[model samples]
Target: MTEKSFAADLKLYDVEHLLLAETGEPPVSARDAEARDRVWEMAVRSNPALFDGPVVACGGVEWEGPRTLRLFWARVTYRHYALRRVPGAVALPSLFVNVLQPDTDGRVLAVRMSPSTAAPGRWQLPGGSVEPPEVGAVLDEATLAGQAARELVEELGVEAADEDLRLWAVTRGENGSIGLTYRAPARAEATLHAGLESARAADRARGREPELDAIALLADAAELSGLQGAHADYLEQVVRRFTAAG
Candidate 1:
């Protein structure tokens, strides 16, 4: 089988229904497991904030029909991603959700990762790896929307009702990772800035660093070039789709 090229353009899908099915965790060989552990330990030494907490990974994806997709997921921890450094070891793709938070002027919000993060200084949407659902619970579109809304509140101090989030697009990017992008109700730019300041203060009060260090609102993909940092692979694609929709 040909290894998928990470350089390939991201594929976008207009998925209305995401049918999730569990395949459990991917099998890791003894050699790969040892290597993964070593890599993870080194990573932790470099960034103590890197947690091994449970997260979801995408095993595979299949199109069920028009506007519908069947996604196979697995429960894994952040450490599983370290397999990427173990040559010839196949790591499950990541599953995550992000919000395309836009201001009243139609500019989408992008945030810079703080020094404490795994991808420090990278610019991306406000989101994180999908946490595993509670025991015996199912992962679905509504659940994903709830996660997206919670991310905005946690990262930006912006409150959004779960029902208010709309699944805007699904994207497949490098390493076959899947990203679920949701559209949030537009808010005033001033309101967003105030929320960010409040959230930063709250984090500092807890003796922790804010997850996001800075933010920018862009009306189109062209504006992304002005941000001085590596960008999330799907950022440009998602931003283009957002701007073109207007």
Candidate 2:
């Protein structure tokens, strides 16, 4: 059969398209099989017969497109033994965090950032991917207190002694590809800096301090629930343990 040229941007949608790249199933699992079936059904939702063979998905596929389109191929392969989407050439590194905080008023000090960030209009702890400059003494130091302290001063405009920060927890990727190390104030703070100018131009952008939006004292898990996404989940787990210890 002659290969038909597809459109530049063919769109595909299915349950399989929603597969989380980091979810608990194998790269291709039974869940993926189900997802693929759902996506196939969705494809046939229009024509009702594309499930029999390899149905071109996503207009011949663009290697430079979004991650979702590429995942359809894996789902189809695992479930229908077919091809629904084409692969893209993009490889984005999964993110790891370096959330830091201060202790005050029986409440874990948390900072909110400008929602204009990549996560968009959400609150997260102050931290990010570790820098190459932080590689020296911190490689063995899981908490990397020294680096966290420096980040506090540089990013958050807070002065924290290395000895004044404590490790709260270490969240690692399932396969241990990376770890999100958390640290918090060992004592009350004397001053705080937003690190707006230097931090923005240096790393994130210009004057992009999320912590500048609004900060609140979280009383308990119920109160902290006001936060969204993984940050909320992480704070619940970490702060609950903190409360139990006190």
* TM-score of each candidate structure, all chains considered together: 0.95, 0.47
- Which ten contiguous residues of candidate 1 have the minimum total lDDT? 1-10
lDDT of 2 by residue, 1-246 (tens): 112222323211111111212112124445555665676566566543232531111112122222222211111122232223313211122223454464565666555545444344445556644332222322324334566666666556666677666544543232211224456554344343234444444544544343334445555656676665335334555555556556
Candidate models: Cα lDDT each = 0.89, 0.41
| Model number with the top TM-score | 1
* Model 2 pairs in collision: 10-59, 63-88, 63-89, 113-210, 113-211, 114-210, 115-121, 156-193, 157-193, 200-205
RMSD in Å for all candidates: 2.8, 17.0
